[model samples]
Target: MNQPETNPDAPLPRPSTFPDGLRVQVQGFDDQQAADGLGEQLTALFVQMGRYFDIQRLDGVTIAIDYEEALRSLDRGCATRELAPSRGRTVGVAMTPSVLRDGVLKSHVFVDAAVFFGMLKEDRYERAMQLLAHECAHVEVNAHYDRCFPDTLLRTKYMNAQQGARSEVILASWDEYAACALSAKRGENPEADYRETFLNDLADARERGNECIKAYRLHSQVGQIVREIREIYGGLMKHAAYYLGNAAGFGKSWRDDPAVAEALTEHWFLPFFERLETALAALYAELGVWPNHDGFEVIGDIGEDLMCEGGMYFYDSPDHPGEVGVQLPLTPDTVPY
Candidate 1:
């Protein structure tokens, strides 16, 4: 493996290898038998997901086992450094007691190693799969965004404007949700069963006015705020269902009623996408950049446009009231050289 060229006078360049073409390298293991076993398992899982990334399992991709090296490599090269570095460095999975107890899945993307050895040691195959899927989804999403979004907007607008939030996280969550949902629908293993059970319980809890269950599961929040939001949304949804069912004579099963479904589908999903668009637009505005329709055609683009328009143009005005946009502070401080 080639080591990153370090220059104290300049920022480091991002790693250029594509995830699909990269190979996995393992280190710190005592024997070949153990490494091979883990490699085969990972290959099988990757194949199952229909991801055709080249995964060469070798020993000694890097001298250090930690992820910081890869992160440093990314920070030097990429303008938007967060998701790409972490997603790009994952190579192999290892078992570590600390990770297991903390429920953290660490990736060394530059070296192409991801550690799931901890989960496997605990016999948590299903959870392991979920984590793998999540990380892989990050790579996929980042690739898609790179291909779809313009390079100019990505660097000047998207990278500079959006902070703390990651497209990888959004994509990963959606992937996990879909995978878990499919597994549950198919009556799969323990992990799938748990996900399905959780969704069902959330549904039940929402019906019974159980605030905790409704909020945490639906909006991905913990504690009172989640509960409050869930309660409000659930109540609104329920009331909407009641009104539609009564008007349509669809009986008490409005949860599955077509009318209610139509309303939520038309109202909720579209608005959600619109809000995302507004947020992205606002971010662009902060960077003094504007996105053309070509780059903003898809969901990611929509998000960018929304942020720009809402944050930069419509914020604090009743004429464009309720327009969602990015909330970046004006005149951001210069990043240290």
Candidate 2:
């Protein structure tokens, strides 16, 4: 008997849990009073979100206030590199196991101590709560997908090929949209935050594209290395979609904005993004009211449209023999560093 070949880009296994039933864990606060206060805040937040979202699968879930420590705890059973926190608007994250168990993700949430406490120091309690709420919404979203699409491994299949990767990106963008939409509906103003973040991500995506071109041209290790390089850019583009998702969820338009136009100059992403936004707007219109098969098809249609319009995907490189070749919307000459 032989073992199956594993997908290198597949998500690692989930973190181990203790027998203790503590749902909120706070660390690094010197004063016990401060730690206790933070614990109460987190517990209350979870309770509030759980009630509103009707989330009932939080039995094994844990909320860690210290991100580094939380990542260490989450990385314990994994052999791969440690998990990293997102460095964007909200430095918090929610994660689930690589595979669902009993149609539940049992997701956990982690909040960066520095960001959370920094906002507290500035008396930005509302913003800090908003960040936590956004992450909580992510946990709900994960659970919803896991339960609704129990047999699917879409996120885990991201690195299977270009279509899988693109699907992964679109799914991630949808997750952000759903999360932000939930938070916005709960009285947090994610729309205002997205108004600025979207342009920043556009500029970042532009720079990433330029760097990818430069690296692709200069590197001798174009086979495996180029594939890795493309994935790096793809990851950044995935984050850029987060902001784009924000716009769609909030019904905000950036097409007429001068800053967005300037950022997209000499860039080929505008049309693709417009198409994605249209797909997302459709999804947004049906949020929280998924109709079984129709809901799944609605999500699937976005990927179909994305692949159809872009004319870019990962394909086996016939020219390079064993290597993977990618076709992107932008050419090497699209932007020069």
Candidate 3:
């Protein structure tokens, strides 16, 4: 009998067993084998990133996917980054991309049915992996901002901005824009470029007479934010949903999922970004952060609300009273951990 070929690129024996700092807590699924495979894939992805980015502390995160309630959460309205803690130690402190110290520091992600099913669909698994990568990118971003600011309110403003006092919406959206640029997983797994995939899908849509996704790079940070500010989602969101659904074969039961992505693209994204840029200019004008700008430099030593101190990263203002702010966290964390 012929022997199956072996992969030369398979990782060498590591010091630890499975699930180092990064872990998985799946709920509402009865399919153990499939879930285990999913968990293993996610764990390997994290491990690969840990070594590639040199993030020793990458193990401090847990990602949960509750297939059942995920769609329910979307039905009612929900936010991404739904499974994280609320403190400095909880947010994590992976000192660099290459080294993440493992410990009590925590961050997490919650994937729902729409994305879960999409990931399982043939030819779409790697595309969904990029979305997961976006969420993973969020872990470090959270660690950077949450630990950078000792005060909850300051971190709140940095993350949520016009978003409500509890919303960490902006950071999530920003990272989403940052994470999907690569063709596939950077360190280990090889897959198609997400941008290329989207373009090919867009071409497929165009051939089918759909044009909502616009033949531009919707995969970039500035592109997403700028488009949303222009109220692009108002018109394009539904069409995009149709395209996304058709591409994934998700059908009508998952119709709203893409709309939710579209809605979030508009609401949570714009305010924080608008305010952050304004605040950055103010900080530079005041010269608080010269060259070495850690994410926390804007927050000051003791969690001073930068907006009130002649700064503006949110709509509420003592200087400009009665101005509107971003929408609040409209939904609860579906898989609170």
Candidate 4:
């Protein structure tokens, strides 16, 4: 018997449960008496978003809190950075998993309830809820992809091909585009001005990275690594700001832009690296270490298939394997410190 090859980007075999509405659950927050109230609000907000996007649904989300022992005490399944309590603006982490809980396969989410409430009290109410909505969008996308292509093997972005990504990458970018644009449709703030916050984060990361690059100017390896990180992430940040700022029409706001619409629908990565690579090569040719190699190939040793934190997603780069932290995954699985 011959089964047809499955298209990696093919739609899910089954329909989404959104028509029935999604569900949410909270765990591990009893210690912080205030956590329950926040959890309840977050859950309600997520449910409302489900009604809005209505494309895919999560089985259920398991949001947990751990604020007493460590100010930041949560980590998602495959975190690229170690989380510490000292990191200010602390909010608990979240993740989506398809694993057995008590010997039965359960897929859900976990979050830090206390940290979330703290942010809420600080009047960051809009941003806090938006983050939750973004994470849910991620789970919804991943959940559907997992079921349809349960055995699909994806490569880490470490090689050179350009412009193609895994279903996972598409999932990440789509949700990011949607999450940012969703503001016009479902948020308390009509335009959801918080989208600019990501640009601020990007500027901070790049500025800090530039400082490190200058400090290690003589260190060839260090310089090259820093350069790569900036170029790859810079493109995503640029696109995120574009998608978020463009103010797409309500209901799948990402669709408002023809480019974003087609890129996501066709399952391709925008921000072609060639231009960025060319600029980088010219900028660093004086270093005399980059030209010796064809293109970056360190992903095998360092890249992880998935890295999640609320707004940022570091995963396989579609065009080239061995690259992590390039595409945007909206569903950020957090780690408890």
Q: Which of candidates 2 and 4 is the stronger one according to TM-score?
A: 2
Cα lDDT for residue 66, model 2? 65
Candidate achieving the largest lDDT: 2
> lDDT tens string, model 2, 1-337?
1112548797534322222344566766778687777676666556655655634544334445566566766632324346676554444454533323454345556666666667678877667667766766776676666666665542343334544455555566677767776666444465545656665555565455445555655654534433443444444444555666655556656666566667777765666566556665666676555556454444445443443333334568777755556554345554423
Each prediction's RMSD over C-alphas, in Å, is: 16.5, 11.2, 15.2, 15.5
lDDT for model 2, please: 0.55
- Rank all candidate structures by their lDDT, best first, as comma-separated numbers: 2, 4, 3, 1
State how far residue 295 of model 3 sits from its true place (Å).
Answer: 9.1
Give a tens-digit lDDT track for model 3, residues 1-337.
1112448798744543224555554445578787666566656656655443323324333233543343233211122223222232112211112121232333434555444455456446555554555455545444444354333322223333233321322222222222322212422232223223333332332122112222223343433332232222211222222223232221122224453334335442224323433433343232322334343233221112322211112345556665444321112121111
lDDT, model 2, position 37: 72
Query: How close is every model to the real structure, measured as TM-score?
Result: 0.35, 0.69, 0.39, 0.45
Which candidate leads the pack in TM-score?
2
Question: What's the TM for model 4?
Answer: 0.45
- State residue 89's C-alpha deviation in candidate 3, in Å: 34
Better of 3 and 4 by lDDT: 4
Local error of candidate 1 at 35, Å?
4.0
Error of 3 at 110 (Å): 1.6
